[model samples]
Target: MKIPILIVMLLLLTSATSKKMWKTRYFTKHVVQQQDTWCVHACMEMSFGIPQCMALHRWLEYSQQLIFPTLNCCDLITPDNYCNCVEHGGVARSEISSFLRQQFSPISGVFTDLWDFLPRGDIVQLAFLSVRYTSTYHLVVLREVEQVEDYLWDILYCDPEVGYSTRVYNPNKLEIIY
Candidate 1:
């Protein structure tokens, strides 16, 4: 009898702790979607996070609906020899980046690849030895733009799966790089 009671208590405590952890993980101050553009609205109203990033596909769908009311979002993703909605390779990256920039002004830079689409290193200092190549690629908010350092912004994206909870660098710990 006592063993069963103890087990039940342990389970209850574990569940309570897990719930608290989840709450903190998914916590966002606000979330909003524009009538036509979801990504822009999300970035403008809410702080960028993994949850928002994960919803990229969905936002794409929503945007497609607004752009082409007749077609669905899947239609856009589907491959096409002609100029359908599907865009592959480097072209897709550039198109997506351009589309994002057109909708959002807060985004100062963007970096896209055949596989991953992200922001440029205008805000974050990356690994050495390249005037063009950037190691860390993702959107960053420009806090200051110095002539010497160029541009300064807090790191917004780290790992998409883990989600970006805070800035990549802390002024106290890291030095600013141009």
Candidate 2:
């Protein structure tokens, strides 16, 4: 009887402790955008820890119903080709925010000043003007912010355009929409 009781107590303790450990072990995976226009989808995947294809499929479904009534689901197999079927080849900020709120939890307010409002290690979708293209906007995932000095800070992000993670110092024209 004592042996069985001891075994039950040990099993209960292990299960209880394992739950706490599992929560702390949660981490986001770095997902690269499969296509040029899938940057926002990739950011969503990284932030929510979902697959990029899943994000695209869900967003496409959502947008088709409300925003793009005439939109057709063409070439479902190829995401890159499917992106071209959209009007702008990308989604607007308002649409992205609305989708996020309805699909996931509500995000914080839009912050133009990254250093002032954003906290460290907070994953956020960032919008900025394209450096290579003229008057074009691009989206990336802001993975982390590390303060380098009193006024200087390093911004780490996953750039879907380049399909990798890169760091920049004091990026300009940054728009954070939750």
In every candidate, how many clashes are there? 3, 0
Model 1: per-residue Cα lDDT over 1-178, one tens digit each:
9999999999988765642100111123444432222333233334434333234444455445444445443334333432233221111223444554454344323443311211223333221110122542223222221121113223332222222334333222222111
lDDT of 1: 0.32
lDDT of 1 at 102: 52
List per-candidate RMSD values in Å: 16.8, 11.9
RMSD of 2: 11.9
Runs of candidate 1 with Cα error greater than 4 angstroms are 1-66, 70-92, 108-159, 164-178
Q: Write model 2 residue lDDT over 89-168, tens digit each, in one string.
A: 36665576676566655344343555444552234433222223455556766555655544565766666667677777
Superposed by TM-score, candidate 2 places the C-alpha of residue 100 at a distance from the truth, in angstroms, of 2.3
Which pairs of residues have clashing backbones in candidate 2?
A: none
Worst 10 residues of 2 by lDDT: 18-27
Error of 2 at 168 (Å): 2.0
